[model samples]
Target: MEVDVKLFGDLREGRFEQEKTQLEENSRVIDVIKKCNLPLEHVAVCFVNNCQAEFGQVLEDGDRIAFSPPVGGM
Candidate 1:
């Protein structure tokens, strides 16, 4: 399946800001994270198709996923 992905904050520093990646069938959010080599600890939230998602959330073809690193300070 092909999933559209985007990264926010420092998560995209050494990686792509947005991309369309191929993943195995039934791949979950965490799978994509691993495929991108993102630091699991830094992933603060996930959005699938613009809605909040959990790591175990299943992904589908053409789904849009955004991964954001934790934001701090006030």
Candidate 2:
């Protein structure tokens, strides 16, 4: 079981390289975040398969997970 993870915005930039990760199924969003060594404070938005999902949501195989920071411009 594997899931596709897509990082966006500052999150992607912070990770240096590699925008995607294949994680085991039944893993929660938080698990991936931890595996990536990403700080919780840097996360502002998260989606699963186009729907807003919580960090605790258990990921399923083939799920598309997108992560991004809060973006604002003036």
Task: Report, for every candidate in turn, its global Cα lDDT versus the true structure.
Answer: 0.96, 0.79
Worst 10 residues of 2 by lDDT: 12-21
Model 1 regions lying over 4 Å from their true place: none
How many clashing pairs per prediction, in order? 0, 0
lDDT of 1 by residue, 9-74 (tens): 999998999999999999999999999999999899999999999999999999999999889841
**73 in model 1: Cα distance from truth in Å?**
5.6
What are the candidates' C-alpha RMSDs?
1.4, 2.5
Local lDDT at 74 for model 1: 11
Give the true-structure RMSD of model 1: 1.4
Per-model TM-score on C-alpha atoms: 0.95, 0.81
Lowest summed lDDT across 10 adjacent residues in model 1 is found at 65-74
Per-residue lDDT, model 2, residue 74, is: 11
